[model samples]
Target: MEGLTVKRAYHQHCGLAAAMDVLGERWTLLLVRELLLGPRRYSELLADLPGLGTNLLADRLRFLVARGVVRQCGVGSAQRYAYELTDTGHGLRPVLLELTRWGLFRPELSTVDTVRPRWAFLAVEALAAGRHAEVDEDYEFRVDGEVFHLSVRAGRAHGGLGPAQPPSVVATTDAGTLLVVCAQPTALTEATHAGRLELTGTDSAVRRCTALLTPS
Candidate 1:
C-alpha cells in the first residue's frame, strides 16, 4: 500500500492482477531481473540497463523500496548505497525463471539485442529446472572476461557477481559459446574438446558440473 500508485491501480481482487499492478509497468520487471544476482549500486544498475532514463530508474527504485520489495543499504567500506531484493522481492525468482524459460523459445537473437555474462546465471537457473537438486557445488564462470559464480545448494541455485571461493569447477568461455552449449547441451563435450569452452577442476567435480550443464 505504501508504494501503490492509486492512479494506475487495477482495482482488481485477483492475486495475479495485484502482482501485475506492481510489476507490469514498463521496465519494472527488468529492474527486478537486474537485481536478481545480488545487490547493485545505482551506477551499476544504470550501466547494466541501457536506455532506461535516470529519472525513471530513480522513480522505480523509490516505488520498489516503498513497496517493500527492495531496500537500500550501505555497501562496502565506502558505505555507498546499494539496492538489494528483500525476502518479498526474492519471491519473484520463480516468476522470473518461468519467464526466462518461456522467452527462450520466442525467437533467435536479433542484431540489436544485447547479452551480458551476468544474465547467463539466471538463464542457467531457468534451464536447469531443478536438475541441481541433489547438487551442492560451487561453479565459477568467466564469460568474455567477466567473472561470476554460481552455488547450488538445497535444490536451488544462487549466483553472485564475482568469483567463488575454492570453486568446485571453473568454466571459461565467451557468451556465444555458452549460449550454444545451453541450447545444445551435447555440444558441451565438443566445445570443451575444441577449446571453445574450458573447464577445470578435479575430475569428479568437473564431471558433476558437466552433467548439470548438459542434462539429458
Candidate 2:
C-alpha cells in the first residue's frame, strides 16, 4: 500500500464501503474495465480512455498498484512497462459484466458518445454467460476495420485486441450491424443473408459460435 490515498473513505465500516474505499474514485473502475481484456501499455490505456488526464491516470494507477489490484510488468523485447490486473483485480470481472448487462438497458448512445470495436468483446462476454460457456472455441471479429478475437474455455471467455490464429470462426461486420447482432442475436442470420455480416468457417464452427452468442 505504498501509494494508497487517505482521501475519499466512506468510513461506514461495511464490506462494500471498504471495497469502495479503493475503487470509489472516478476512472478507477473504467481503468479496471480497460485491463479486463488484458495488460495494456501506458500509452494504450491513455488512448483507450479519452479525457482522463495524464496526471489523474498516473495517480489512479499508483493507487491500484499499491492496493495489489494491478502490477507493473515488462512487455515485448524492449521490456517496456505495461499494467495488468492481479488476482484481486480479476475478481472484478463478474462485477464488470454485471454492470455491462445493466448498462445495456440504458438509453442508446448519443452523437457525442464515442465507440470502439473492442468494446464489443464486453458485450459478447456479458451476453454469452451460461449459454455455451462450456464450449471451447476461438472466434475472430473484424469490426469497422479493427480486428479482435475471443476464446472460450472451461466456462471462461478470454479476449484480445487482435485476430485469433487459425480461428474456428470469423465474423465481419460494421459497428452498427454488430450492435444489432449483439442486442438481438437471432438477427445474425438475417444480417448475414442481407450482406450486413460475413461469417466464414466450417458449418459446425459457425453453428457453435452462433449458439454461443445467442442467449439461452
Candidate 3:
C-alpha cells in the first residue's frame, strides 16, 4: 500500500469530538458570532473583531463557506461580498448563548476591559426569557457607535443589528456603561439621571423597553 498523509481528527467517535471537528478551529466560533447579527463585509468583521489578523479571518471565512456553515453574497450593485451564516451556522446561537452566559456569570472569566457593543445582543437574549409585553415596543440601543434594535410584542422578543424605525425608545451610551445599566437597577437609574446614558421616549415607553431588555 502507498503511504498517504491525512489531517488529524479527534477520532474518538463521540459527539463532543464531532462538534470540535466543526468548531474547534481558532476563530471559527467568533467569526460565527460576528455574522450572527446579519451579513457582514470583510472589512466590517475586521473592524468589529479586534486582534484578528486579515489572513486568518479570510481563511476562516473560506473554511466556513466550504463547510456550508456560511455563504457569500453580493451586496447591491457595488458587487461587494458579504458573509452571512447559513442555517447550520445560525443554529449555533443557543450554544454560543450558553457559553456567553457561562462567561458572564463567572467574574474571573470576564473582564470589563473587553466589552463590545455586539455583546448586548447576548445580554438581551439572555434576559428576555421572562419579559412581559402587551403591545409591540421597539427600542434602538446605541453602544459605542454601533446600533442595535430590540423589540417586544405579545410577550415575545425580537432583535437585530442596526437602527429601528421610529423606535419606541432610543438609548445611547458607551458599551461599558450600557452593561452596567443593563445589569444593575441602581446604575440604570443613576445613569439616566446623570446623563451617562441618554434615552429618548415617553417615560412609560422607556420604562417598559428597559424592563424588557435589561439583563436579569
Best candidate (score: TM-score): 1
TM-score of 2: 0.84
Give the alpha carbon lDDT tens digit for every residue of 1-216 in model 2.
Answer: 555456588889899999999899999999999998778899999998999998889989999998899999998999899999999999998888877755654334557866777676677767665454577888998988988888888777766788998799998887766655666646778788999989899998998888876543
Candidate 3 off by > 4 Å: 1-8, 106-114, 129-135
| lDDT of every model, 2 decimals | 0.81, 0.81, 0.75
Alpha-carbon TM-score of each model against the true structure: 0.85, 0.84, 0.80
What does candidate 1's lDDT look like per residue over 1-216, in tens digits? 454444387888999989987898888999999898888999999998989999889888888888889999888999899999999999998889878755654223457877787666666667665564688889999999988888888677777778988799999998766766665647789889999999999999988787767634
Clashing pairs in 1: none
lDDT tens string, model 3, 78-185? 979999999999888777856764454432224635767887556665455346557587888888788888767787666688898879888888777766655665
